[model samples]
Target: MARFTIGYRTVKTALGAAVSIFLAQLLQLDFFVSAGIITILCISITKRDSLKISGERIVACLIGLLYATLIFELLGYHAVSIAILFLLFIPSAVSVGAKKGIVTSAVLILHVYTVGEASAALWINELALLGIGIGVALIMNLYMPNAERDLLWDQVKVEDCFRTIWKEYAKYLKEGDSSWDGKEITTASTLLSDGKSKALRNIDNHYLRYDDYFYHYFAMREKQFDVLESILPFISTFGDTVIQGEKMAEFMEELSEAVSPGNTAGYFLIRLDELREEIKEMPLPQTREEFEVRSGLFYILHELEEYLTIKKMFKPDPKRTHNVSGKRLTRDLNKKGSKK
Candidate 1:
């Protein structure tokens, strides 16, 4: 029964409609039921979207009312007049970017036609109806419980998938031949895509436009995923595990464990610089196969540097930052060493 039950959004829409109808009646507006219908149309999954769309609907309704009045006054109410009104008003509404409100606009036009006249009183009543409906929808959508927490959970899921992928990369580097199924890469991609979509919806739940931290965070992760994908082909080029390869494997393992919010990439960046110097000091390759391996290792190192730089450039929300303390960092490093 719980699975079959209607959602909270549906309940909110129903409540909004009821309130709109009651308000319309209290004000003694004609076509009071139209207010309820408008309320239903205005209800959206998010408050910001609801407000935006309602404003458009109101504008479209007015345009529709104007066109209907002019057409009806010029050519008395008839089937031909209704057809002509649609032909003209639909294009006019589209031109003004109020195409979304066409259905509601049609309702207003038909209302005017049904009464055979467009009087001042009728106009006032319709305006009142639009106001009550849109206003009620705005009020109902103002509160969204657990929205932030839900977004955080999505963020954590995406990060966990990233950690798993990095761990697999580490194994591939250490063994030179890995049994990794590549499932985690697909999983991370899916999670990032889904998380981004949800964050965009969450952005629409607020009135202010630019404070959508999760949206930006997911976008950054999406960019990093491209770098991760590039590294996979380079990983498969390994002929044999050399000393530098083992060091990179260790670095990847450490990186996987450090994948948390507010974790700094400065330590990893310094370690990468040291690794680059060590490669520079190593003996030059003599054979063609040795040269290919050395060149591939340098390319892999360059990509790894880029991967860390992306994280270094990312700035997480200050309020949400759970800064990894020195004590926590020590503990995490110890745990990774113990696992190895």
Candidate 2:
């Protein structure tokens, strides 16, 4: 029973459908009508995908039913007609419905069951199953919205769209981590996309109102996207130079870690604020090529390290900062606070 419950989305769906089915007959509608409603409720969208899948399926099923009905009327309800219908009707309807297998199934079932005005029992059963399938799918989606899971791989692919630039950054930096290689960037993109999508999709479920939760979730994702965009070109140039002189790149990475934004060490932030002042005094590179191509990466790192340093000042490290740095530092960490 446990395995069976895990194997299919049946347990919850069955319970839902049974309750709906009972409600259907109780409402004086036929068993099929109740089942159909149940199915629709089950397969409804819980994520941000819109009714794209459900709409597609409904359309394909209707087309298949219509096509089957026409063929049966014109050619008679013979075995050959069913077979012919399978060939022409299935493919034709499926093409319109984007050729999704489930869509095709809905269409085929509707088509065959409604042929020649079948017994009411057959119609009821067919409608019930269709409704159950759709309803169950939707219910499952809404409760735990798989927007995160569904878009993960695709998001990874989209992030790779910026990979050429990042590779250049890594090359310029001359010191790359194979683990944090081009692939991990791709993976991070995917995770962010999935997370964002899931966050958006949780709007309609009958469970917790994740609308607020998702809002913050996607907002973070959007910030990550912006950060990656800003750093891409710089990383490319930095990586390329780092590769040219490995030791300097290593030193730079170490320097970065020493003052990284996540750390409690004040050295990175202080050095960066000082370096930003130095960049102001330095002469400009002669050309765009010189600016991007010939310039050393330490300068860029210094600028970034400086910016991160400033950003870090407000970020409190709770573990080490067990004792407060007075009210000033606490208020400073609050970016929105109106502190002079």
Candidate 3:
């Protein structure tokens, strides 16, 4: 949320300039551009110099005008329009993703030129259009500016990870059902891993955007993410273990029940029940030895009833960070007793 306001503001400011410029041209006056620039100024002041969207707007306006001029009139090179287009666009997009870059600017410019018209009225109209578009963007987002687009995106990505991890936990539980089919588990695992992998991409983005403002913030997020990353793979393994263990338990129960009379086979239900309990209270290692032991045991126990019970009893809270020291995000959801 913090970052969103910043990024949105940047987009708003740029588009506002576009609209203001275009309107000024259309109106045969400079009213729109003046208004638009003022709007940008207001945003800049309000944002405490945190917003950097103006740079993009300036470049966008200049490039859009330039590209149109080149394609339609300025660059009357006889070789080929296609060649110029390629030369103009390829590097622009490659270097900076076309957005706020030279390539996309050229594309927008070309679009304007192709639309037809080049009189004084037309040029003014074009500028006005640009200014008006930019102005409108600014005005609408005036109250809710995003000075931190990238950072907010990072937060969004991190939140997604939390959802994915929970889903994975759920998937692992599903594996324990006697009638469980592997398809759902596999699909869930795929989604879980995919979400986790995607989460990493945001970490770097977050670090890049926020590290400058807050000391050690990026480092801490990175460490937390690292720990979380390790858990994903472990979770997958543990989930599989749970499926197998519960399946074994169920099989034993069925076998014991099927035994016609008192026989050695009838004790399978009792043994299965005992195994189920051990899995529930999975201990997080308090010491190095404990850590190693639990980590190892996790693989074997997710298949147990104890593991399933505790996992169900203790859902991870989005508002809370487990086993982390220092500042972290919190959840408003009900807190289950600690598993560790």
Q: Quick one: best lDDT, which candidate?
A: 1
Q: Cα lDDT for residue 219, model 3?
A: 31
Predicted candidate 1 versus true structure: per-residue lDDT over 14-100, tens digit per residue? 998999999999988888998999989988888778887888898899999999889999998999999999999999988988988
Tens-digit lDDT string for candidate 2 (1-340)? 3453342334545565665566555645433454544354434445333245656565665565666667776887777776776688667756685454344455445445445554455445455555555555565555443443333333333333333333434444574443444554565566566656555555544343443444343444345445555655555544333443343344344443332113443665555566555644556667675566335444455445544444444543343232322233334444433551
What is candidate 1's local distance difference test score?
0.81
Ranked by lDDT from best down, the candidates are 1, 2, 3
Q: Runs in model 3 with CA error above 4 Å?
A: 1-57, 64-127, 138-340
Q: Which prediction has the highest TM-score against the true structure?
A: 1
Worst 10 residues of 3 by lDDT: 325-334
On lDDT, the stronger of 1 and 2 is 1
Q: Candidate 3 on 1-340: residue-level lDDT in tens?
A: 5554556557767776666666665776633445455345435433212123434554554655654466656555334654675576555544543344343244344444555543466556545544454446445444542323333333334434433433444445446333323343344334445444443433333313432321122333334334434444544444334543344334433432321111222244356466546655544446664454355444433333332232233223243223321123222111211331
Local distance difference test, each candidate: 0.81, 0.48, 0.43
Q: What is the overall TM-score of model 3 with all chains considered together? A: 0.32
User: Per-prediction count of colliding residue pairs?
Assistant: 0, 30, 52
